[model samples]
Target: MPKYILFGDYCENALEKRTPYRQDHLEGLKQQKETGILVTIGPTKDNTKVFGIYDAENAEQVTELIENDPYWKNGIWTDYEIKEWIQAF
Candidate 1:
């Protein structure tokens, strides 16, 4: 499997209206991690950005996984970009 990074920002209105769902979103990611779909995930320390790393067979698989996320499906994220990543450490 290869690894990729997903970079995104939360929609302002969604952030304001769905605080509890935000926690659910994170819990979902944690489940994915336990299932071996997610390598890691977190928000930037300053809180302006968010990202996730995943181990997948290909970019399309990664896209499908991300697109199905409650956060992405509910418009919690305003924008996102995905890129193949090389993990040296």
Candidate 2:
């Protein structure tokens, strides 16, 4: 499996409205974790940005998975960047 880093910022308005869908989004992420896809996820301490890492087969597959996220579907994240990552440590 290849590792990927997903970087993005949440939409201000959407973040305010995302509480209702948080559980669903978490459930989806939980499934991914069980499948060994999600490595870790969290928002920056300041809460201005969000980022996550995942182990997937490829970028396309990862992108597909991200597109299915409840947050993404609900417009919580309006912009994002996905890139292959190498963890040398």
Candidate 2 — which residues are off by over 4 angstroms? 13-15
lDDT of 2 by residue, 1-89 (tens): 88999998887765577898899999988999999999998887766577999998999988898898888898887778999999999
Q: Can you give the lDDT of residue 19 in candidate 1?
A: 73
The top-ranked prediction according to lDDT is 2
- List the candidates' TM-scores in order: 0.82, 0.92
Sequence-dependent TM-score of model 2? 0.92
Tell me the deviation in Å of residue 19 in model 2.
1.2
Candidate 1: give the clashing pairs.
none
Error of 1 at 55 (Å): 0.9
lDDT of 1 by residue, 1-89 (tens): 78999998877655475575677777877888898979888777755577889898888988887788777788777688889999999
